[model samples]
Target: MSSQVIENHRANAEIYSGAPICIEKSRQLLDEISMPKGLLPLDDLVEVGYNRAAGFVWLRQSKSKQHRFNRIGKTVSYDKEVTAFVENRRMKKLTGVKSKELLIWVTISEIFIDESNPDSITFASSTGISRTFPVSAFELEEDGKK
Candidate 1:
C-alpha cells in the first residue's frame, strides 16, 4: 500500500481509538503534516506511532501547535526498520524484566495473529497417543474454579 494510505489509517485509528481510516484521507493528512516550516522533523516535533498489518498501515501522532508542520511520512520499507528496532531493543543490556515481559507479550500476540482460526482441538504425538485438549478446555477449567 502507498505511504499516504498508511498515514491516514494511523490518523483515523488514533483519533477514534482503532477505527479504520481510508488511504485517501491518510494521504491528505500525511501531505499536510510533512510540510517543513521553521526546523525539526515532524515526527520529532510530535510523538509519532505506527502499526503495519500486511498491506495496511496505521499511524498516529500527538497534536501540537506545529501540527501543520508535522510531516507524517511513511517508510519505503517498514519490515527492515521494524526488525532492526526490535533487534536493537532486544540487545539492550539494560532491559531485564521489562524486556522479558515484552518478548513474552509480543510472542503471544504473534502466535494469536498467526494462528488465526485455530481448531478447537489439537492432536499430540506420543507413545500412548494421549487425548488432546482444546483452548476451550482450559477456559472451562478456569470458569469452573471461579
Candidate 2:
C-alpha cells in the first residue's frame, strides 16, 4: 500500500522530564507492545501503547508547536520541527502465513504531544483498532515456520 509523510515535533522529547527519546525507541516500544502504529502522510506509521486503567501510555514522537519570540518588544512566531514522518515498509513478510492475513496492518492519521503536558504524547488513528495489545501478538514466526 502507498503511504504519506508528515512532520511533527512534540514527540521528540519528554514534556515533563525534558528527556530526549529517539524515534527508534518509540518504534521499538510500539512493536514490542503490539500497539497500533498510526499512518502518516508518506506511508509512515507510529506504534502507540496505552493503559486506560492506570492512565499510562507511550508514543513515538511529540507534536509540533508554535514558538513565539520577542523581537524589539514585538511578538514573532515560529514553529518547532521535532518529529517527522516518511514512507516505510518491511523488506519482506516476516510472518509465515503465506497470505495477507498473516500480515497485520494498521493506519494512523495523526500524532501530537499532549497540549496539557509536553512530555506526554498521543497518537490518533482514524480507524477504530484498539491499542491495548501485548507485543507478542505481532511477532513473526521464527525461522519462517509458523
Candidate 3:
C-alpha cells in the first residue's frame, strides 16, 4: 500500500479501537438514557464495549461482574459539556459540576456547586428552571438501585 493509504488505514483502525470507540459508545448510551422512557440502570455499569462479533454492545458491572439489558430507541441531543456531565454522573465520578440525573427532555444551561455542602449540585434548565440534587445518593459506585 502507498504511505497515504497505510496512514488512512491506521487512522480508521484507531477510530474503531480502544478509548475512542468506547467513549463514543458511552456517549451514545448516555444520549439514549436522556430521553423519555430511556431509563438505563447504569449505577452498576463500569465499562461498556461494542461487540463486533455479535453486533451489539455489552456493559460490564465490574472487573468480575456482568449483566445484560435490553436496548431503547429514543435519544436526546446534548452539547459536549452536557455529554461529559452525564457520563461522569453515570460513572459516579466527581467533576467540577457534580450532579445526578434530572429532567429527561430539558437541556442544562448552568451548573452550580454548593460550597456549603459539596454533596449538593444545582442545575439550571434551558427553560430557566433550576433544580438541585444530592450527590450523596451517587457517590458510591455500587449504589445500583438507580
Candidate 2: worst 10 consecutive residues by lDDT? 91-100
lDDT of 1 at 77: 14
RMSD of each: 18.3, 18.9, 13.6
Cα displacement (angstroms), candidate 1, residue 123, comes to 23
Cα-lDDT of candidate 2: 0.27
- The local distance difference test score of each candidate is 0.24, 0.27, 0.36
Clashes of each: 5, 21, 0
Model 2, residue 3: distance off in Å is 9.6
Q: Against the true structure, what is each candidate's TM-score?
A: 0.17, 0.21, 0.31
lDDT (Cα, tens digit) per residue for candidate 1, span 10-89: 54343222213332334333334331111111231122233322223233333211212112221111111110001110
User: Per-residue lDDT of 1-146 in model 3, one digit per residue for the tens?
Assistant: 12232233332232233444454555465445331112233333444443332223333332221112222122323211211223222322111122223444554545444557665655566556666655443222343346
Tens digit of lDDT per residue, candidate 2, span 1-146?
A: 11111112233423222223234444443444333232111111133332323223333223422221121121211122212232122111111111111244333333344334533333334554323222222223341244
Error of 2 at 136 (Å): 23
Worst 10 residues of 1 by lDDT: 80-89
Pairs in clash, predicted candidate 1? 8-26, 10-59, 33-70, 33-71, 34-71
Name the top TM-score candidate.
3
